[model samples]
Each structure stands twice: as C-alpha cells, then as structure tokens.
Target chain A: MGASSPDLIVHVDTFARVNMVYEVLSVISVIMLLAASLAVLITYNWRVCVLSLAVQYLAAFWLINLDYPLAMAAVKLVVGWMVCAMLGATPVDLKQPDEQLPGRLFRLLASAMVWILVFSIAPSVLQWVPTGMVILWGGLALIGMGLLQIGMTTFAPRIVVGLLTILSGFEILYSVLESSVLVVGLLAIVNLGMALAGSYLMTVSGGLEV
Target chain B: MNAPLIWIVFPVIVSVILFFLSARRYLVVGLATGSNLFFVLLGLLLPIDRLIKLGPWAFEVSSTLMVFGRKFVITDSDAHLVVFLYFFAAFWFFGAGVVRAHRLFIPIGQCMVAIAVAAISVEPFLYAGLLIEVAVLLSVPMLVPPGRRVGQGVLRYLIFQTLALPFVLYAGWVSAGVEANPANQRLLQQGVVLLGLGFAFWLAVFPFHSWVPILVGEAQPYVSGFLLSLLQTVVLLLMLGFLDSFAWLRDFSVLSQVLQLVGTIMVASAGIMAAFQRDVARLFGQAVILESGFALLALSVPGYQGAEVFAGFFAGRLLALALWALALSNLAADGISFGFDHLKGLLHRLPLTSIAVVLSVFSIAGLPLLASFPVRLMLFDRLIPEAVNAVIWVMIGCLGMLMGGIRTMMVVAHSQEGWRFEERLPPAILMAIGLLGLVIIGIFPRWIMPYLIQLLDPFQSLGVLMILPLI
Candidate 1:
C-alpha cells in the first residue's frame, strides 16, 4: 500500500475490465450456440427448447449490444440452432446409407464450415480483395450458409434457410456499400420477422404431427 | 397509400384474430373465407392509383383506381384477373372450409394479395418469384392430405419451388448485370432456358409434371382447384408481369421460340397422358397441364396481338378451370374415384353435378360459346403459324384435349339401369355460375376482350381500336 502502487492498480483494473467485456461477449455467444444446439436435439419436445433458446438468443442480443463482434457471432448461433434441431427431429436413424442423402448432408456441413471459416478470416480477406470481390465473397459465403440450411429435410429449416440466405446477401451488400444503421436496422427487423414466421410454422407443424 | 389497402389489411387482421380464436376447430375455415372475400372486394373496388405507392419503400391502395406510374402499371386489364382471382379464392376457400380444415388459407390469401400487389407495383418486375414461393408454401397444407400425406405434396412442392429459386436468382443477376446491352445474348439465352424450365416446373410441364396429378389425386378437390386455377393464374400473371416490365425479355425472339417449343411439348405430352388417364382427377390435372401448355404456345407467337391474345386466353381459361375444378371436387366426394367406370352412371345419380362437370369439361375443351372457346381459337390461330412444318402436333394437342372432354361427357352422361342414386347434387349456385360463364363468355366473346386487352397492355403495346394497324 504505497502511494505509487495506486496508478499501477488503476491500469491493471482497466485491463481487467477490457478482458472481462470480451470474455462476457464470448461466453454469451457460446451459450447461445449451445442452447440453439440443445433445441435441435430435443426438438421432439420442442416448446421448452424453443423457449429456452429464444431467451438465450435475447441474451446474445444484449451481448452484441455491449460488444459489436458478438453480432456476427449471433449468425452462427442461429445456424447451429437450425441445423442441430433439424438433425434431432429427423428420422436419420432409420434412413438408409444412400449416397445422395449423405452426400447432401456432408455438403451442407462442409458449406457451413466454409462459411464460418470465411467469416473468421473476413477482416484479413478484406485487406487482400477489391470492393466488388469483397461483396461477392460475402454474398457467396452467406448464400452457402443458406444453401446448406435449405438442403435439410424439414420445412422450418428450408424457410429459415431462405431467410438466412436473404440476410447473408443483404449483409454482404451492406458491408460493401457501408450501409447506414437504418438500413441495417430494417434488415434486422426483416430477419427477425422471418425467424418469428419460421418459429410459427414449427408450432403449427407440431400440431399437424400430433 | 390507398384506402383499399386498409380494406385489405383490416379484414386480414380480423380474420387472423378469428383464426387464432378457432385454434384447431372448424371455425377457422369460415373466418378465413369471410376475410378472403373481404380482400377480394377490396381488390375489386380499389383504384389502381390508390392501390400503389411510389417511393424508396412504397405501398399503394385504392378503390376503382390506377395509382402507380407507367413504370409499374396496373391498367384495366387486371380488373377481371383480380376479380376472378378473388372470387375464385373465396369460392375454393369456402368450399375447402366446408370439406376440410386448412388453417393456411387465410395466410395464403394474404400472400396472394401481397403477390398480386407486388406484381402490380414492382419495377423491372423479377421479385414475383419470392412472393410466389411464399404463396406455394402457404398452400402446402391444402395440396397434401391432412393426416397421412400431411407434408409430402407440400414437401415436393417446396423442393420443386426451391429448384426454381436459383434459376430465378440467376436470371435476376443476369438482368441486373447485363445493362450495356439491354438484351444480353448469353444472358437472354440463359434466361430463356431458365424461365422456360422454371415456368414449366411451376406449370408442372411434362416429365416434371408428376406433382400435378399426384397432388390432385390426393388433396381435396377444392384445394386442388385453388392450386391449379387461382394460384397458377397468379403465377401466370407474374410471368406476364416479367414479360411486360422488361422490354429486353419481349424483344428476344429466341425466348418466344423456346416458349413455343416447351409449350408444344407440354401440350402433346399432357394431352396424350390425359387421354390415357384412368383417374378422373388426374384427367383434370393433365387437362390443366395441357391448357398451361397452350398458354405457353400462345405466348410464343411474336406480335402485340399474340401477347394480348395470350393474356385474354389465360384469363378466360383460369375462370373456366376454377369452375371446372370446383365442380369436379364435389363430383368426387363420397368415395368417388377418377376412373371412367366409377363415373359411368353419374348422370342419373348426380344430375346437377354431372351438368356442372359437363360445363367445366366442355368449356375447357373450347366448346362453342363456352368461356374458353374464343380464347382457344385465338391461341390456335397464333400457335399454328409458329408451328410451321410441325402443324399437326398442335392439332393433336387440341384434339387430345377435345377427346378427353368427350370421354368425360360420355362417361358422365349415361345412366346405368341398376345403379342406385346416393350422392346428391351440389348446391345450384356452382352449377348455374359454371353454365352461365360457359354460355355468356361463349356467346359474347367480345364482352371480356376489352378488359383482357387492358391486362395484356402491360406486356405488349396496345391500341384503343378493336383492330390494330400494322406496325
């Protein structure tokens, strides 16, 4: 407890706060991803998972509000939710080892992986590419994600895939043009509306099943 | 911007609330139909100007009006199409309500309204694909049987539609990118191929046409009619919009030729299939496919008149088909099969229903004074010149359609000596409307021409005069 140590303490506290912010955002995103995954696994008993994931998704939104990088993280959470939920609900166990089906599934997985990789390295990739190429890359990546989701057996997945593709295309376009928050906000609203619709269909379809 | 949009929105809101209230109950059907009728009325009364809004993000509404500019035009031509679609939707929706529980009808109708509005209002006009897909999905429950086939038809329908998305997106990309040349030769070629394939898929053309019969064979007749007639008509309107909005599309001779080739193939194949079909429902399905082919063939003929004729023929055929499907569905109820043998004594057993069937089948066959007769004559005239050396193919298709009609009439007209009458005739209103439509449109072909021309104008250049001077 010397007078000189107070300045050092203050510096350490600021550094810790920055680390805490990043850690919290990262944790929030991971939890969302996990929750989305769990929703897919127990989709037969979907209401509880849907409700839980929806809440987790809201918390993720708060994380993104506190930290911008977490916004990009939300896309993965949604995709994870969709893909996992689809796999959980599908009668994949009884299905044969048809090459076409497995090939499609593998392609979907590969596409998702490729998209995530692309997004992870997008900042570095941007430095190497021209504006048009950047837009093209971003669009293709989002589209790939969409295409993957669409390839699934379920209707909810297909609808979600369509919305995601549209979102990806819009996001790429936004990035290329450096669009204003208003456009982004509207786009987010549209995406959210689509998600709500997809969720509603899942509910109705659940009734159809019973 | 127009008050009628309010009319469209308000009823939808009310119906949605009602639908939720009904839950899994039958009340949803009535509320949905009532709401759909309200939407139809809005379309009928709303002015074109009031129906459209022009801005960065525009919305339009009106009663008996034309709201938007020439860039996104909705002339008097759309009146009949809209009116017919509304009533057709209402009729089928009500019929479906009576027979089945389709919770999607209300939402589907709303999507239809959105599609119609978007088609009437959008610029460069390629956005219809997304809206149409939405409509198709909204129609899923109606296409497949509720219990066992709960998701199959809709699933297949969805997959087929998904296939169309990329083709359309590619077309849009091509159109957007190919600006230096208004018509991109390669892009146009790609577009012609893609659109021809895309529409053929939508229309269930030939080899890819399995979905049509499969759906009709399984779903309730009312649902089948809505898909075949009302929903299909909207898709046709969307195609018309695309051809109308883009000068480059209309200018491409290759595109027209492709449409002819596809249309010809479809007619020939579908007609042959229809002629050999044992299922009555499937016969009707095949008949729709053939009619769709004829429409494509008519669209292939180059000239403003050809385009106008195509529009008129499409509108007329849609009305006829809707009536036909409605009658056919009722005829099939009570363990009815599509086989000729099953319908052998339909005349004596179900006289009113038989008559409704007769009117629908005959009208579709282009019987004189029926709604479709004039349209077919006009379509054949245009298609014949384009067929050149292959003239007989078109003839065979037409003849096949006629033969199918004759077969249905012959089968339904006879009464078996020992057969007992059990099934009662459907309500008189359906029969009266079908017969009246047949006779009125057949006798007075000119009655609907002006309105048809107005609808066609957006696609082609039209003159006010009845007959056009050579360009």
Candidate 2:
C-alpha cells in the first residue's frame, strides 16, 4: 500500500514536482485544521460546530495523505464525517449565555498558547514519529486544540466534537507507524460508538433539564 | 468446538438473546443464570484435547480458535478461571433477580463478562485494552439507565476508562521494541511506566478513585456492585497476566514494594473516608476501594502465595459485596433514601435486611466469623514480619471500617416508638442464605482454596514461585 521505487525512479523529476505540490497542500490543510478547531471552540451553535467538524475531517484527510495512502486516509476521513453527521443529527440546545468580548479574547489567547506549545514540541517529537514535520505538527496541534475544547465545555456536542478531533490526531500519527486494517476498523467502530453515546447523553441531559 | 466458541462466542450469543427478551424480566434472569451455570459445569467437566465418551458419543474440545490472523486460546490450565468467572456471573445474575434491578442488567452484564473473558484470553494481550474499552462502553447504558440524567460519576468513569486505552496500546508498542533490544533500559522504563498508568486507571488507584464513590452514589446499588466486582476482577487478572507474560516486569525488584505502598494508601484513605461517609450508598463505594487495596496487598506478597491470597480475598469480597448490594437494593425499593437522615430507626421495619447490611459491612471489615476474616488474617500474618508499617496501616483501615459498622448498627437499631417488625418472605430468605454463606466460608475457607490455587496454574512462568505451599 505504498509507492514503488520503480514508479518514482522512472520519473524522478516529475515525482519531485508532485512532492512539492503535496507539501504545499499539506501546509494549507494544517491551517484549515486549526481554523476548524478554533471555530468549534469559539461557537455555541450546533450547525457551526458540525460544519467545522466536517472541515476538520477534510483537512485531516489531506494531512494523513502526506504519509498514508489515499485509501487508508479515506478510512479515517469517512469515520470522522460519520461521527460528525451523527452528532449533528442530535438536538443539542446549548443554553450557554452570551459571552462578553473579554471571554472571547481569553479563549483566543488560550488557543494561541496551545498552538505555540504544539509548534515548540513538534520539532523534538518529529525525530521519533515516523512522519513528516508538517503532518506531525498538524496532528499535535489538532490534539492540543481538541483537548482545550474538551476541557472548556460540558455541552455534549462540543465534547463529542472534541473527542473526534483528538481521535483524528491520534489516527494521523498512528497511521505513520502502523497500517493494519484491523486496527483502523476497530478505531472506526470506537469513533462511531462514541458519537452514538454522546448523542444519547445529549438527549438524556436535555430531557432531564426539561 | 473450540474453547473460544464455547466460552466467548456462546456467551455473547446468549447475551444478544437475552437483550431481545429483556421485557420478560424473569425469563431473562433465569436464562442468564442457567447459561452461566451451564458454562461453569462445562468448564469443570469437559476435558480439552482429550476425547470423552458421553452416552455413546465421543467428543473433544480444541483449545485455540484463530480469527483474522489472531489466536484466542483457552487451555486446560484456564479451566479454573473459566469456571470461576462463569460462577460469578451466575451469582450476579441470580442476585439481580432477587434485587429486581433494571431488566437490562442481566443481558448487558452477561456481555460484559464475555468480553472480559475474551480480554484475558486474547493473544498479543494488548488487544485486551481495546476489548476492555468496548466493555466499558457497553456499561454506560447500565450505569445511567434510560430516562435518567447522566451523572458526573458516569461521565468521569467513561472518560477515565477510555483514557487507559492509548496508554495500554502505546505500552504494547514499546514492549515489542523492548523485546527486540532487551538491554535497552529506556524502552523498558517507558513500557513499565505506560503499563503502570494503564493499570492504575483500570483499577481506579488513588487519586483516580474519586469516581468510585460518585458512581455508587448515583447508580443503583446492585448495578454498581456488579460492575465494580466484574471489572476489578478482570483487571486484576489482566495485571497478573501482564506480569506472567514479561519476565522483566515480574523480576523488577521494586515492584512488590511499590504495590505495597499503593495498597497501603488505598486501604488507609478508603477506611478513613468510609468512617466519615453519611451516605449509605457511598459507604458501599468505600468498601469497594478497601477491597481493591486488599487485592493489591495480596499481589504484593511474594511467590504463588500472593496468587492464593488474591483468589481468597476476591472470593470473600464477591460474596460480601453481593449481600451488601442486595440489602441496599431492597432498601432503595422501599423508597428509602440512602442518606443517614432517612435511615434512622429502620431496623424495626426491615429487620432481616438491616442485619444483612450490617453483617455485610462487618464481613468486609474482616470481623470474626465472616467471609473476609480468614483471608484478611492470612494477609496480615504474611505481611507483618516483612512490612510492619503496611500491617499497621491495614489494621487502622480495618478499625475505621469497624467503627463505621458500629455506628450504622447503632443508628438502624434505635427502633422507632411505633415501628413494627415487618419482614417479607423472599428477601428474608435470600438475606439469611447470603449471611449464612459468608459465615460458612469464613469457618471453612479451605473448601474453596484448592479451586482458588488451581487458578494459578496457567502462569507457568510463576512455577518457581508456586513451590511454596499456598495455605
């Protein structure tokens, strides 16, 4: 499930050009990943959260494709989107009151700090992880932001999205080392199951409040 | 039939059937109990890898079943464990009926047991982490029943249990590297730390144990008891299996000392907390924490004697917990709040149940002539000379629990002025039988020691440790 040397060797110059394009795409995807994470953290609307989650999955696919084959990367992308759809279908009425400018500013500052932390540590982590620097930093950033989202909210949909983000980051890093189909399938099940549990809890919590 | 088919697949099938028939509460309970008993008998009587004639038909069971390039093996040596797990399932299912718990308890509880068995039996044991996660996921519905608000305890329990997965998987990955480069101390240390963190989360060790009381406080007493007993037993067995599988891990010199330290903290803190708890349900949680502490101490004891101590302690605690949970469930059914304020002078209205509840606490606290006493004595006798401080802390924990029991007895037995001594037929009989079983086991623990020791046979690497007489 990888590119053969003969295919690369036959058109070395062309392969190099394609690799440069892939590198640019990977960088762009990482930016989108962070943007989606920020959207989920800053917004209280479920629709906005769902849309950002979809963007996160799309960006994760491109980031994962930097190391993993397109097919393997698609497995993660599909599972992420399925989880997003499941969560979106649930009726989560986030009753969070209006946040003042100071609250928004504080959240933004916290997220920036997380980004700095990830960027600082990714260089050292890249030595051990079996992936390119771009993929590693992107995965680490997603994980850090996901953790922030989870820690900041008790609302079920946001927490579920946060969980998905964390899992996506792990999958990106794990794919670089192990490419077992069984592991991928099991992880997919975990993602879907987690989404279902989140949806159930959301409804139950809502019902109890009513 | 292969062992996996018999032990794993069959039980899973039964669970699915029970789930569909959940509306028929009695039938579901009866079927679950009957199936568990059948498996226990099968484990005891069937000879794997050897033909046995039964009424003109000859058959032999295979020990291994391969699925998707992975092997699930259950050998002759695992017979005792298989029997014990199934017997526990039967005991739990039977009590579920007596307590009239949620109808889904038997079905989901059956599945949880099967997955736990599979977790222990799975090859390349790291997969057990994922299996355990699945079991934890299955428990959510049971923990927070339908139409109920999800409590912080349930959420925290899920989060903590899920958090163990990555640690375990990473440990498995690193351990493979250690196997390749045995001299690499860095890899060894990393694997040990990761594995330790994973087990600590799984077992709910100190600082991670806040969920225990919260969970028991919110969930039904019977469900919480069943979940705690089942998960703790499996996780402890998995920890033992980890040690047995890796010689480096087992031979780590400081391992026993570390275990003793953790065990001491759990015992002391839980005991002190139990004494202060005003909520009856939370007291049950404290007892569970104390039970985990004792289990750790049992593991800390050197040689196969540790294994014997663990099995005996586990057996006694299981009985004690079942009785305690049953009594609590009956009280809850009577519309009584578990808080101290509501429990005053209730012994007159519920004489047998009150006795069972107090007796169960005393049993767990290691009072004389109760189930846990003999094992507690064995553990203390073994540890006193080697770790005197540990002995002192354990005694202090036991004393705290005894004090709590005395206070509870005094409160319940105050006897309201106009209260009548009322008792129902079924619960009275059940509580009496449970209390009687505790006493008999305390007096004749030897009846179960042979079976308990047999559970140690699967870890062939521990053969050197097994040279010591278990009793």
Candidate 3:
C-alpha cells in the first residue's frame, strides 16, 4: 500500500474504551513495562536484564494490540522475544563472570528522575501526538528510561537493550499513526539486524577477554 | 530484465554468493569489482524502453520493477548516477586488494552499494532512511575487525545514525499532513524542522560529527575511508532528493542561509582542528569533515549552481580519499603508526606511498595541479561575490589544511643521507597511477565535466550552472 493511504485511521475514543478484559491486561502491561524497564536501568545482572527485557516485550505486545492488528502486534512480540533470546544467549556462550554492580544509588536516582520527567510531561505529549493515554505515557516512559540506560552504560549488551527499548517505544507510537505492511516488515528486519549485530559485538568482546 | 532487478536484486544475490566464497580474497575482490564494472557497462550501453542492437540479440530493458505494491523505477535519466555509483564501488573494491582488507569488506560493501541505490530509487522514498540504517548495521562487523574489542566510536556511530531514523520518518509523517493541509503554517514549520534535524544528524554536521574523527582513529584507515565516502555520498544525495521533493523546503531562504552558516563553521573549525592534529588518522578525519563542509557550501549556493558545485566536489572527494586511504593502509600494514613522530624519516623507506599520501593531502587542501583545485576555485569564485567573509574563512580553512599537509611532508621527509627507497612493485605502481591521475585531472578538469553535468540532469529544475566557467 502507498504510505499516504488514509484508510489506516485510529479511533482513539473506541480504542481507549475497549472491553474490561483488555483494559485490565493493559494496566497490567503498563506496570510490567515500567517495572522491567526500571530493572534494566538499575541492575547489571544478565539474568534479570534478560527476564526484564522479555517481560517488557510481552507487555508491549498487549499495549501495541490496542493500536495495531493482531498479526502486526504479533510481529513485535516475536521479534522482541528473538532479540531477547539472542542477547540472553551471549553471556552464556561466553561463560562471562557475574558483572559487578556499580553506582547503584546513581542509577536509582537517574531512573527516578526520568520517570518523574516522563509522567510530568505525558499530558502535553498526549495532546501533541493525540494517541491514546495508555500509549502516550507508556511509550514515553520506555523511551525516556531507555535513553537513560544508553547514556549511563558502556556495556554493549546494556546498550543494545536500551536501543531495543527505544525502538519498541517508537514502534508503539508509530503503530497508532500508520500500519503499512511494508513498514512493518522493514521494522522487523531492522529489529533482527540490531539483535544480530549486538550479539556479534558481545561475542567479539568476549573473545578479546579470552 | 528491469533496471531495478539488474541494479538491486542481482547485486544482492551476488553478495550472498561472495559471502560464502570470502575465504579466497582475490576471487571475491575480482568478482565484486568485475560485477560493478559490468553494471557500469550495462548502464552506459542499454537504453531503457528502447530496443538495443547487440549482434544477434535485440531487446529492450524495462525501467520499473514492482514488488509488494511499491515501485523501484530507474529511468534513462538516472543512467549517469547508475554508472557513477557502480564505478565508485568498483574503484573501492579494486583498492581493497591493495589494502588487503578483510574479505567481508567486498561482499558487505557490494550489498551496501545495492541497498544505497535502492534507497534512492525506492518510491515513497521515506523508506530510504530505513535502508540506510540497514546499511549502517551491516557496516558494524566490517568496522570492528574480528577478535577486536568494539570501539566507543562505533557505538557512537550507531547511536547517532539510529537517532536520525525517527526524525526522518516523522518528517515523512508530518509531510503527509502538510500535503493534505497546504495552508497550515504550523505543519509546514514542523515538517521543515524535522527534515533539517534528520539530515543534520545524517550528514554529521559540526556538533554531530564527533564520531567521524573517533571512528577514523580507531578503525583501519582504508575501511573507515570507504565507509565515510559511501555514507557521505548517499546521505548528501538523499538530502538533495528531499529538497527536490519538497517545494516548501527548497524555496525556504532560511534553509540556504542555515546551510551556508553551518558550512562555514564546519570548514573553519575542522581546518583549525586539523592544523593542531598530530595523529595522521585524525588528520584524515579532519579532511573528511572539511570535504563535507565544502559539500554543504555547495548546497547553500543559489539556484542550480548549488547542484553543479555539489557534483564537482563529490567527484573530487572520492579520488582524493581513495588515494589518501590507500597510502594510509599501506603504512598501517607496515606497522607504522600515524603519529608524526613515528612517521619521521618514513619517506626514506616507502617513498612512493609517502608521496601519494602527501599529494592526496595537498589535493584536498586545494593546491594547484590537483583534482580538488578546480572545485575549490569554482566554489570560491561563486561565494566571493555573495559573501566575502565566507570566502575569507574558507581560504583560512584551506590554508590550515595546507599547513597540516606541509607538516606531514616535513616529518616524513626527515631522512638520513644514506636513506634508500625500497618498495614492492604493486603498491609502487598503484601509488604512481594515483599520483598521475590527480595531476592529469587537475590540468584537464574538463575531462570530468560532462559526467558532472549529466548528474544535474535528474533534477530538471536545477538548471546547468556555469560550473568551471573558465574551463
């Protein structure tokens, strides 16, 4: 389809007032997104990071479904899970030592600041983008938190996860505005490519250590 | 076969095949270079939608290839660009042999050319941003050699390039809104801002350019040069395409002023920084930044003159960079660090490579009898009448670069009385040819003018400016 097609409209009023079950699931998903994103930012544990990344994607799948079709939403979940798997496998293949937690207080302070900023400006962002409240707050929070993670860390895997989180946030907002199959397919390729490059970088670093 | 199929899919298929055969470096390089040359020949000989006589064969090549409801069209008007890109790829591949870069460079570099071409040719061209990102991703492994730790430069490169994606896509989104509501000043402003930011990041203008010097410092000089050359060319073309596609953007006087201002800053700052740089790799980086500054200057020119200036600057840059990078690569292979101290007396050992490196620097500095001199002279003549301060600052930048080149030459030539020139035949021949090409082009600048003019044909509104009027 041409990118300019007007058929892909978002009925925000109806979408925001979906059935009770979806509403409950969305609430649960938002909480999961926030908690997992916090975990990713605050901790250096590979296991925790991987699990949190997976949970974040699962939550993304539920929230994204509000704006995109089932198939399109599923693509996000599948790609996210695949990326999680690849990132999770790297530390194991390398037999990496447990990472020493550094600057816990600093991380906590930064994460808190980001969360506060995102929540404070969410209403204005919602007005600007005109998407649903759920997506506006959730996507913005993830994006802000991801930027913090990326800025604070030099570790390749952490940076990769941060990139993924940022991309996920964008995908959520973009899904609300346009839903061309071609764009979706291209995004999927991009996600997979990032995952693979991240994995290779981690491997190269691991080999250097040996 | 359609032009898209020939230019896009065929290269991709060949790339994949070359990937498996990458163990044989010579074979991969030969095949990749040969394929690129074949495409150049094809683009020159075949007329789209018209029957061609080839002895026992007569057939017309189609221009459009539709897939997944999107069209990739390469018309006869695009023949010059097709040949330019392929010839560039071939030149890069051929130089890869001299540098002995990793096998992945050939295959991945070939794929990059195809994807970049597709990015420009793809309809609903916003998708070009995504394709460029993919090309960036593929470049990572090649940039970070195997078993080496990934440098901070590569990471920064990734972040900055990724950062551009959203801005570009959003611009496309906002553009749709502006198109629907042509009278909305707010929407027009928003679209213009997003596009400006997007191309700014993509082009690595002054502030966003922290990655260029760093990447050059850490990676192989040859590989980094190839990456810089390819990315800069494609991104500049993409920017031009954006301007061409949007009348509001092209006619915005403020944008031209912004281009001019940014170009001036980049040139002035990069030149000052290059003069103080001790490391040769960083000096090369400065040269790239300077080249990009000239490109932005060209874009700032009024009317179609900007396009002409851009074409000349782009062609000159490719030759200058190839020569510089090849010499740097040879020095690197000889266990030579790019530091001034380390390079002292090196001209005694590798006279040919040293001469090639120094001449390349001088060419970039706009010395007489070199490839870049004509382009620089044209840019100066055009700007002096318009902005004297700009002309003075650009001259200062060029002078700084010339000083840097002189410093390098002095250090390299610091040799004992009994010093001897000893070099392998291949590199010697390559460097000689490179030096000769630079001088010949400098004296006969008009030899390349036809091709540069042809590049202007795609933009119908960009009339043929009096580029190189004296010539």
Off by over 4 Å in 2: A1-24, A123-131, A207-210, B54-57, B464-470
Q: For model 1, what is the error of residue B204's alpha carbon versus the real structure, in angstroms, after optimal superposition?
A: 2.5
TM-score of each: 0.70, 0.93, 0.93
Tens digits of per-residue lDDT for model 3, B1-471: 789999999999999999999999999989999999999999898898788888999878899988677788888888778888999999989889877988788889999999988998888778898899899999998998786678888888888888788788878888888778878887788888888888878888889999898998888888899999999999898887777777777777688888988898888888888888888888899999999999999989977777777888776788889888898888888888999999988888889888988888899989999999998898888888888998798888988888889999999999775567767677678778889889888889889876787776566655653344345
Could you tell which candidate, 1 or 2, scores higher by DockQ? 2
TM-score of chain B of 3: 0.96
Lowest lDDT sum, 10 consecutive residues, model 2 chain B, at B462-471
Query: Please, what are the lDDT tens digits per residue for candidate 2 over residues A142-201?
Result: 889888877776555666677778877877777776666666777787788888888877
Q: Model 1 over residues B1-471: C-alpha lDDT tens digits?
A: 443344434544664575466455456656656766766675566655544544666654433323232123343445545555556556665665444435555555544554555445444455455445555655654454234333444444655654564455446545654445664476566666667666766777767777777667767766666677765666676776667656677777677777777788877887777667766777778778877887777667766666666666754576666666766666655667767889887877766667766666667666776787787777666666556644467667767766777787788777646545555434446556667877887788777676666555444442323543111
At residue A147, candidate 3 shows an lDDT of 91
Candidate that beats the other on lDDT, 1 or 2, i.e. the better one: 2
lDDT of 1: 0.57
Total backbone collisions, model 3: 0
Q: What is the C-alpha lDDT of each candidate?
A: 0.57, 0.84, 0.84
lDDT of 3 by residue, A88-118 (tens): 8887332233554547667777878888898
Q: Which stretches of candidate 1 lie over 4 Å from their true place?
A: A1-210, B1-4, B21-84, B94-107, B145-148, B180-184, B413-415, B418-426, B457-471
